[model samples]
Target chain A: MEAGGRLTEDALIARYFAPLAGAGADALRDDAATLTPSPGHDLVLTADAIVAGVHYFPEDPPASIARKALGVNLSDLAAKGALPRGFLLTLALPPDWTEAWLEGLADGLREASEAFGCPLLGGDTVRAAGPALLGITALGEVPAGRMVRRPTAQAGDRICVTGTIGDAALGLALRLTPEAPWAVALTEAERAHLLDRYLHPRPRLALAPALRRFASAAMDVSDGLVGDLAKMLRGAGRGAGVSLAAIPLSPAAASAVAAAPGLLDTAFTGGDDYEILCTVPPGQLDAFRGEALEAGIAVAVIGSVEAEAGAPVFSTEDGAPRAFASGSFSHF
Target chain B: MEAGGRLTEDALIARYFAPLAGAGADALRDDAATLTPSPGHDLVLTADAIVAGVHYFPEDPPASIARKALGVNLSDLAAKGALPRGFLLTLALPPDWTEAWLEGLADGLREASEAFGCPLLGGDTVRAAGPALLGITALGEVPAGRMVRRPTAQAGDRICVTGTIGDAALGLALRLTPEAPWAVALTEAERAHLLDRYLHPRPRLALAPALRRFASAAMDVSDGLVGDLAKMLRGAGRGAGVSLAAIPLSPAAASAVAAAPGLLDTAFTGGDDYEILCTVPPGQLDAFRGEALEAGIAVAVIGSVEAEAGAPVFSTEDGAPRAFASGSFSHF
Candidate 1:
């Protein structure tokens, strides 16, 4: 489980990649992985890369790294309401990894692939001296006309979100300083909840059908809520006003906020939240919530889209507008 | 161009990736690049990575790097007799490259994209500390029944190759030692031919139709004539005898061999020859030559496949064999 040691590329591939089984094109040996498109569905494909250090902790378990790598790409397909088909993985590995680490990583990929109903089709592996990097290209399919896009939101659409926000960011803050006052006071269950959110984010593929049924503009919340929502607004050529008080937080997160007022910064700007942030027309909100409930996804109406462009307004419970120091994580 | 400079990931991406004119998917800007399968042809996809020191001169022009990055993958598809379709590029940039270097690289990609009739589909760009690297996932397609594979060669197959062989290897040697005695004697046309072979290898897509007409199995000779042919034999589950004297060497390469007695080592083991190596049934060799001639491709008989499996035997003009110090490049 050591972060930087114990895996040869060949051994890692054998342990982590060999057992993947599926009914896709040719079973993992050719130069390119192939998938036969289903008759009634449109094929959706996407590729994303996770660089070491920038995306994950260098010391984190390889399994967690693998999950995050594949999970993030799948999350995009989920937002499009596509059914999982298959994926192609490309890896650049540092020479120090042992066989066990790679096996653990592949175990994570296999678990996610099966859990999400997608199977590994093919991939390439190489050696690198720098941090290990991964590029995963995922393929999916959806019935014609069901895929959602970010530029289609209506002026009066209600902005909605799935699950609680800010917890993954909170978990990241705690991991950075485990001895911080907020971290020391957490209950075991709360700590585990935060850690799990940081480690393994579940892409909401199951909710895709309902999303396509009702949502207008849709995208995963990867950058912080304020930033990603702002992007969605820009993509749709609109704007939104969010009720800061209405932003959902776990009980533990609320407690952490109470203890350390600065935790709000983590809540607003920290990235890696994979939950779907979407816009639904006012009349469809009720039906959308009902379907999401049936699908076991937490649904919340946090704001409404504006007809014109402006900065997102955040309001406190007392109707006082609050100020945010930063909007999102900046690559620069 | 210098080899090791730092460039921001965003700046590199902007400089190197032109706005793809007709990319079919919107998810390309979101979390992943998307693809919708084209109807009719079976999609042929393949990815290959070129590391700085391993694949080319550390200080080669970025444009040449860009061309070769894509050209190598196209060569593989060409060997399969597939038409050029589209490509996804993944670039890991060393920090030192300037904006101009990246622009030149993009220009090269754009040139090849147009020349090969493949459009730029999607890709990821990132920064790395070690060597500059490129991973290209090329997608092509052909009619279901026309695609060729390496395992289809039959016994009594008349192994043939398109174009002369040793030019690229000789070019590499000249590039490595520009002032070497052997390189100094080359005329202007010969030097241009050698450098062009090294820098911008034609992928042989033009000969794909003829290959379909005559070749039982085909592949681009990348690793070297001996080694790559060994791979084809392995794929076909057969072995063969090669006449070293019959192997076609370019005029410059022949001169280099005459100048230095051991220069054949460069011809035999040096890599990056992207010419097509194929097997035609003995009875079809005449027809194969006719088709190749009509297509304006040079065809030469090099060897024949036997019903046995082992190391390939290489004999000289007098039928006496000699031992080869090395046959191909091995990453390990």
Candidate 2:
């Protein structure tokens, strides 16, 4: 907690993480946790890592870093139509990290765990000589043979997305340039809304049940809508024709795009949207919409799956196909 | 492939990790993997992370680094008396990392996965601005409600350990000081044996079934015998009296200790000895030994559990209680 001296690994774990360990975690003392599978449920596995300076700024709060680390993994489970059960965290911290930072991170993780019904089962904490790297392996359970896969979308299926797209990407843009000429035209509340979307992702766990029942193929859009949709299409050996104008955009993002038409490419191609991109059969569209609305979520039909085997194509309102400066974000 | 230009994240994953993915991995294109549990089996979950400078030297072989990353997690599953299932990997790589290094790492991971019967399920790869960090979440399966735990050790149990102790510690010492007067006397084979023990740990998965049937408590010794045994005792509300002379040591380690008598403290306190440390009933000692022998593993009884709530005490051949120079390796 106090860096190297006076705070041993055992004491640090006991003080910061032992209390967060839920049932089956053995109070963070055991080598592994025992988790009984619910009868007739299959397990879903997803692992994600977020690094300081790469995923978030070094000036970002520790709580946001922790939330984003777990939130990204949770988003994967939600896309897979699985209910969150538990997770294991592997944290690599620098020597300069402080006890107060760990406390903030634990507080954020605890809040997310309780809110999402996913508890911290077990984890490893190691000292790093580099920037902090936080990883989470989240486990979820879905009924046997019920997981929504990315390779099962059928031709003619209606492609839909939850919440809004491009908000987080625009929010990131705003964060990097709050005083830019285009950004200064926006209201302070609009700026905050965009920034909030970037910092905190709301994984659609509430929609998993609905998605399980209605979606033919689904995935979380973390790497931009155009690129992630292309991945899903490639996996399914199918293609799609999406309407860029139909894609839902937050009011703040819409305002930004209105101020600078060139920002549309950034809105469509930037990553970290954390929204579900799924194909729903036409027959289930009404039911899916009703269920999502009942759950206080917004759903939009953005496109239709084409019979051709190719990448998704985004077209403008005038039927001209749009080309992004970059298809999606990639680390390498 | 280049670090950040021609070798994209997708291409890097395809080149290095796609072939390592086992059944239900969905070719690593999907955001998450689906796994159906075998009937009557519960999951044993464990995670561990190792950083470049903290756990291994930056110049260590990529293959050994990969093995250590996965081996440490597998060791946890072995300690829980579970069969290896599958694992998720999260890797943070620096900009200077090379394709050849990843190739070697993938080769090592593939071999270990095949040897341990634990395949890759899915993973996330991201770029970092600092030293590499690798995290693994290894899962296993045990019969429902039958996971071996450290807190189940009985007072009258005989504390047994698998294989030789202190070899890895000695190996580390030799690595740090090959030209030292104490290390210069070792034969080439002896030095290789110690170095191999430190670089590639053989997780005692073969002993899991025997432990499940015979042991009262079990855990992998990664943080040295002195501290880890104390941890087991504290967990079980018991104590142990271990005879240092009775603790099994490799021929190479024994010779090293003979050369430098002060290395005994290092042997007892240094970490990275990934062996199964367990407690068996005195009555089942013979049967446990036989089963372990049949499985091609050596078992040694080095201590006895005592009916007291305290730390473990190590005694020399003359019955003098030994004191360690350091309790255990702590990164914080």
Indicate the docking level reached by candidate 2.
medium
List of clashing residue pairs for candidate 2:
none
DockQ of each: 0.37, 0.80
> What lDDT does candidate 2 reach at residue A292?
92
True A-B contacts kept by model 2: 0.88
Question: Per-residue alpha-carbon lDDT of model 2 for B271-316, expressed as tens digits?
Answer: 8899999999999999999999999999999999999888788898
Q: List where candidate 1 sits over 4 angstroms from the true fold.
A: A1-18, A21-27, B1-18, B26-34
Candidate 2 lDDT at B117 equals 91
TM-score of every model versus the real structure: 0.90, 0.98
Question: Whole-model lDDT for model 1 versus the true structure?
Answer: 0.77
Model 2, which residues run further than 4 Å from truth? Answer: A1-6, B1-5
Q: What is the CA-based DockQ of model 2?
A: 0.80
Highest-TM-score candidate = 2
lDDT of 1 by residue, A33-94 (tens): 44566666766666667777667777888888888888988888888777788777777777
Model 1, position A40: C-alpha lDDT score: 60
Q: What is the TM-score of chain B alone in each candidate?
A: 0.91, 0.97
